[model samples]
Target chain A: GAGVSQSPSNKVTEKGKDVELRCDPISGHTALYWYRQSLGQGLEFLIYFQGNSAPDKSGLPSDRFSAERTGGSVSTLTIQRTQQEDSAVYLCASSLVGSQGNYEQYFGPGTRLTVT
Target chain B: SQQGEEDPQALSIQEGENATMNCSYKTSINNLQWYRQNSGRGLVHLILIRSNEREKHSGRLRVTLDTSKKSSSLLITASRAADTASYFCATAITGRRALTFGSGTRLQVQP
Candidate 1:
């Protein structure tokens, strides 16, 4: 793709249900990131994936949150037992390899996840 | 603490007026960048300034950096209604490859 792409622009889910947000990064991009933004708020870091290696899941916020990246190109953010506090716009971004290369991050339109 | 923090969480000005937003970070960085996000839309990269560079300009955007203070400012000249958006500052530290973003400033331009 010419830029990063995300699915389900908006999702309304019930509490305790699990939801998966997908991210398809630009072709050849080596680093992918997930961020969450509340209404009128700044981005909250969620996860970072580089290549096929382990991801920096430090920002997942809790045990209910998890993510996976396949083939180093596509990534998914999964939130289990969704809570109202989890409602936010989940954004995906891609950039050239961080340590190995450098470029501005290309962001996706994001999926607005609402937990009711 | 988050590496970057934006000042003046919100700003409102008449169209054609200039807008200036400032950001302060806590750690040494490899580079600092700016981005703008319209309501409910994806963020658009604005400009990036390296640690060694003091200033940069592109189109109507002007950015100034002070490494000693770990601060940066973005100035938009002759701002227009189209510039009404939330602005954010992000920094990628020398050791941390992922960019850390600030809370952001919401700028409103009224005609």
Candidate 2:
């Protein structure tokens, strides 16, 4: 039921400020992911957490961007010294964990971040 | 920087017509997935076709994957006005847990 939920539906911040976005995954799902949708860039992967293992951070655009999943359920994405380029809709997704089995990711409504 | 790129950046068609969109990625993938997003709404997974599958169908949607060409296509037949939205193709590479999304094709189905 509860699909995926992201908090702070919309945010406006100064260019040099920092912001944190939150995500709550569906119950029983072990895989969680973060993505950014910019004006023309579509959806860009940010990071992912599977169980308690080290997250896959290959998609993070820069060192300023970091994410963490605590208790294998809630995740937070922190953007340091935000820039106009960092403004976008942050999306979260989750799915059941497995090997070549089910990989259908349920996505959240997303949080729109605006950096001025 | 992006892996997947979709064609026809935009499409406009009348209801009951067929709409087709194509996507091409840079690297080999284990599976390809299609998603639809209405204006201001979250994305909804339409279908997924593994690399091993050449074509797959679900209701009015048809997805075809051509690994050789590193491309995929989605066809929506007898589309309704409600079908107007942005369609995206995502490719999941082998060994990676994230899926790379394309630029997306905006389809406008007029009633």
Candidate 3:
């Protein structure tokens, strides 16, 4: 089966520029999530979408960061006016929401965003 | 804030030796999961242990969860050089869908 996939394996941009990263979750997956990982650091949750309900935005570091999942399939994360601090590997993952409490997540290769 | 914190930021061992990594979380969790990442790209799921599970085994991997102590441990027996990678522990909070991951342990296995 096809796993999650992300576009633009690597991106380099200047500070204050905007960038959009895309993710395609596995077919039939209802939950999608985005996370950021800085060099030698842990993953920081960004946002999550489940079914048609409201997306969880608690983890978004600032207003400049936003994400939207359309048709319950693909998701895009947009960073407006990016900052040097925003440079990191953006990872996307998807999983099936099961009756059980927790489910393992399948990840994408990720897009490394470099803000120079 | 990060919930899970893995001990020993890095580790090195010889092939065929056993390796163990530990993780500690701050809050109650529904499950704990281990993931392996190669070259800092995609992460592959290794195992998952529910809050009620105290120990689970898959192949040469053993995972133990202690809800009382808010900690978990992953033991890999008879490791191989190919096992060298970054291992991370992630916690699914009691009511949260998103997972909180630890900084990870960089494992180096010499053949």
Docking class of 3: medium
Question: Residue-wise lDDT of candidate 3 within B53-100, one digit each (tens)?
Answer: 999999999999999999999999999999999999999887788998
Q: What are the clashing pairs of model 2? A: none
TM-score of 1: 0.96
List the lowest-lDDT window of 10 residues for candidate 2 chain B.
B35-44
DockQ for all candidate structures vs. native: 0.60, 0.57, 0.67
lDDT of 3 by residue, A1-116 (tens): 59999998999999999999999999998999999999998899999898998998999999999999999999999999999999999999999983233888999999999999
Each prediction's number of clashing residue pairs? 0, 0, 0
Better of 2 and 3 by TM-score: 3
| Candidate 1 lDDT by residue in tens digits, B9-109 | 99999998999999999988888999999886699999989989999999999999999998999999999999999999999887665788899999999
DockQ, candidate 3, comes to: 0.67
Model 1 misplaced regions, further than 4 Å: A100-102
Alpha-carbon RMSD, each predicted model: 1.4, 1.5, 1.2
- Second chain only: TM-score per model? 0.97, 0.97, 0.98
Estimate candidate 3's alpha-carbon lDDT, on a 0 to 1 scale. 0.94
Residue lDDT tens for model 1, A12-102: 9999999999999999989998998888777888888888778888888999999999888888899999999999999999998867224
**lDDT value, residue B62 of candidate 1:** 98
Interface RMSD of 3: 2.0
Cα error, residue B19 of model 2, in Å, equals 0.2
lDDT to native, each model:
0.90, 0.88, 0.94
